[model samples]
Target: MGQYPDAYVQYLVHFHGDRDYFECHEVMEEFWKAHPEDPRSATYVGLIQIAVGLYHSRRGNRAGAVKMLVSALAKLQPMDVRTLGLDAEELERRIRNRLADVQAENDGYTDINLPIMDPGLLHRCQTICRDKGLVWEAPSSLENDALIHKHTLRDRADVIEERARQSRLRKEQGEAR
Candidate 1:
């Protein structure tokens, strides 16, 4: 089996363990940003979209869920992701199933596990989950407001500040022109 990165392991842990899809996107996105030239760039994006889609689905955002999941399915196609220790076929199948559910406006959230093809990778992720005091394959806690509505509930001061800074810089550049 190929070597998996620490961030990917953490992504799996948060994904299957705590059902924190937001964290799944975070860890994988950070890794993707750091390793932009990695061979798995498209795969990373597809995985991130999967997480975001699930998050939106759980939050009852049907339109958002459909958008992300559809994009994810497209990005994942025409690429072999088995090198990343994931069952590419199964992953695609699951994404399709999820997309269908979302398209039908089911309004039900289900935990989607990334099919880890490598035993070593699965073991490593499970070990990390155990160390972090999380149960593997736990279902999403529907009643957890913070988890369900993380995007709106979490602090975004830094994001807002950065956006303002960018706007100011753009305005200054326009004035110079």
Candidate 2:
């Protein structure tokens, strides 16, 4: 969490661009694994929980949303959200608001605009969102039959290849030991 990892920026890309909340979890989890000993690992995990919670909320999974959001808040309690380049107070407020709705099973999933505190980072995220034809902070189409829910319908050859490569590296390193 000291020098923000490249994965965090990539997480923002998927978050704003594709609205692929699952990928947000993957990228951040990978980074968190690399720094398990970091004192702030809980903050990283909390962010992943936020992503998954939002994903569940969008899919109308009220129960799942509440569980993840509650766990995330607990993990986030001891840390300052600004330490991760986010507007800490606003994020907590948004999470709490979302949680209330989730618990009630009434309000729909709201677009959580993670207020990035750093001007430069916000500019970069905005530019990328523009390039991708996505509007930052816009609520995604969540109609029951919408295509976003079927994201796995798209090909993921690149991801599979990367997983295979990483598996080989780990197997080889173990043999060397």
Candidate 3:
């Protein structure tokens, strides 16, 4: 197994395979929130921005794409991509190129194919993708027409119930104190 967390691996797989930007954000965000003290929080957010930015681009939201990509580039500029087991120079070059493409706003969306330097990590990601019956390195798409916008069809009951449960717990604890 690689030194990275399962969440990071999941993020990579969803990124390279399913191209589910929203899912990428969820996995990475959960990891970052769980380990807030880690220096990788910014890194995770940058990765999230890449996914969301691509999603926006694919959906033809030029303005949102530009904003997210710009923010991602700025966050990643100061960090060494190798810390996340990637080729530092190549990753930066790709991001720079992507930023330019996004700024031009001609194409709908560009795939963010980051270079992975770690063989083990790459292998693990590919394996996960295969296990999940997805194609690696394939550009993601909202092919499920009805599922294009997740919130429009997803069930939010569990999330709402969990939030209410947490709220009740907090209130009970406050009263006890």
Candidate 4:
């Protein structure tokens, strides 16, 4: 019991890495039974569910794949994967791609093309645009001007004012009196 979490975690890594979905499910079940109240248990359970979904996906079980993957995604919603040794972005990409493939194979399912944009890139662009006093346009299909302004504009009115003041001072110092 003392080493259950660590041991189970190792097993999970091995099972998922090796694509042994059945063993992944069994190993995580052991951990879940022991650490039923553990806050981090959801992460492990979500991983196992994802592995099971991947296994079904690879074996051409579209219904099972969709069911398990959706469940896995829901289970993962409450936890940050960055602190759990899981690459959340990569997992999302994989899940989205897999779901798209499944949707393509099934009827009455809409294909979703999720944006792959990095949040960090968006933040950097916002900062640069704000500092430059340039208008920023967030990529959106709607043509509403106010919506565009609301989403893209950074609240940097104070910084812009300060920079203008500094520039005025520099200009005044350079002027001949």
Best candidate according to TM-score: 1
> Model 3, 124: alpha-carbon shift in Å?
0.8
Tens-digit lDDT string for candidate 4 (1-177): 112345444443334233345555667778777888887677777767776675566555688878988887877743345544445777777776777778577543222222214454334444554565543442222243332233235476887899999999999989945
Rank all candidate structures by their lDDT, best first, as comma-separated numbers: 1, 2, 3, 4
Any runs in candidate 2 off by more than 4 Å, and if so which?
Answer: 1-3, 77-80, 143-177
RMSD of 2: 4.5
Local distance difference test, per candidate? 0.88, 0.80, 0.79, 0.57
lDDT of 1 by residue, 1-177 (tens): 878788988888889999989989989999999999987798889889999999999988889999999998888744447877888889989989998998897766787888888998888889988998999998999999888888778899999999999999999999999
Q: Comparing candidate 1 with candidate 4, which one achieves the higher lDDT? A: 1
Work out the TM-score per prediction.
0.92, 0.77, 0.82, 0.51
Model 1 — which ten-residue stretch has the worst lDDT? 75-84
Candidate 4 regions exceeding 4 Å error are 1-4, 106-177
In model 1, the clashing pairs are: none
For candidate 2, write residues 24-58 as lDDT tens digits: 89899999999898777888899899999988888
- RMSD values for the candidates in order, in angstroms, are 1.7, 4.5, 2.9, 21.1
Give the top-scoring candidate (lDDT): 1
**Model 3 Cα shift for residue 121 (angstroms):** 0.6
Model 2 lDDT-worst window of ten: 143-152
